[model samples]
Target: MLNLSSHHLQTIQAHAESTYPEECCGLLLGHLSSDTKMLIEVLPTENSWDGEMVDVLQVVDDSSEGKFSKRNRFSIAPQVMLKAQKNARDRNLNIIGIYHSHTDHPAIPSEFDRAIAWMEYSYIIVSVRQGSACDLKSWTLDDNHQFQPEEILTVSL
Candidate 1:
């Protein structure tokens, strides 16, 4: 299970709504225990996905909007990740998970997301439709590297 504060969920939803048409990405800074991850901060990041340039993700956009491209993919810079790690360490926190938005798509893990996941972290996805943020879901990888839905428990901030 993933434990996040009400404020944290709001921040994530807002970020998703703000970045509609393009997926928003961020880091989940928190404490990780044996059975749950308690979030302490939501660190939003810029999506610098300039990879391949094939616009292959366009096919993944099932909506008739068909406005897919690099916007459909998100990449958090390695430098930002390194910095976040150091910052989290300074605060006695760990990057327990990552969060991203899927425009016009369900709040479920995509093939690309599953392929790049780490078993140690949770993945939160928010579905944003036409600029409105909708469903939200969390996923974690099992021993086989396949995504399994995780429960999200909200607590008071």
Candidate 2:
């Protein structure tokens, strides 16, 4: 199970709302104990799919011709993730999971999500409808490389 404070959930919802029509992505920093992953902080990251860099790439790469849009895709740069990992280690925490928002879509992992997910890391997805966050769900990749639903335990500060 994944345990997070109410405030953290609110923050994630707010971020999802603010990035309406586009997907928002971030890292969840926390420590693990037995079967629970306790979330300590949320580190927001820029979605590369929404940036100008991708636009430039599409012009040069034929394979990326029709892809690279934020409405259905979100990507975090490797350097950003590395930095977050190092920072988490410095604070005695680990990047236990990643979170993203699906605008106007259900909070469930897609086929692409399943293909990209790493084993043992929680994947939290928030569903934003009409610029408001509606449903939220957590998932983890199983040994068969498929997404399995995970429980979310919200705690109060």
Candidate 3:
């Protein structure tokens, strides 16, 4: 099971709403050192498939254009991945989880999400509807690359 605060969920939703058509994605960087719990930091980042570590980039689209290119692809930018990795390393934190928003679908993990997910980490999905946020769910990849529902608990920040 994964544990996260409502505030963190809100932040992710806001990002999704802000991104609109294209899809908003990021990394949940922090540590759950003890079995009990720990605070998870929400680091908003761009989608980059260049490398393993995702780096965080500055928000450039402040305007409400809501325009998604024809590609309709979502991923963390290479630079963003690098930055996120550095940030995690400096804080001695592991890549405990990942976050992404579904523009028209529910918070459940889609088939593609399940296919591309890294089995070692938790996947957080936020669903946005008509520019409004609706639901949130987390999933874990099982042995067969299938999505297994996971529980989210509140964490102290």
TM-scores for all candidates?
A: 0.89, 0.88, 0.76
Q: What lDDT tens digits, residue by residue, belong to model 3 across residues 1-157?
A: 6677878888888988888755788888777543422336888776543322212211323232333331233676657777888988898877777788887778887555665678667888888888777888888777888888877887656
User: Candidate 1 at residue 145, lDDT?
Assistant: 90
Error of 2 at 26 (Å): 0.2
For model 1, the stretches where C-alpha displacement exceeds 4 angstroms are 51-68
Q: Report every candidate's CA lDDT.
A: 0.86, 0.87, 0.69
Candidate 1, residues 103-130, lDDT tens digits: the string is: 8989989887886688879999999998
Give the range of the ten consecutive residues with the poorest summed lDDT in model 3. Answer: 51-60
| Candidate 3 regions with alpha-carbon error over 4 angstroms | 32-39, 48-72
Candidate 3 at residue 100, lDDT? 85
Best-to-worst ranking by TM-score = 1, 2, 3
Tens digit per residue, CA lDDT, model 2, 9-92: 988899899998999999999997767899999998998765575665454444555665787778888899999999999999
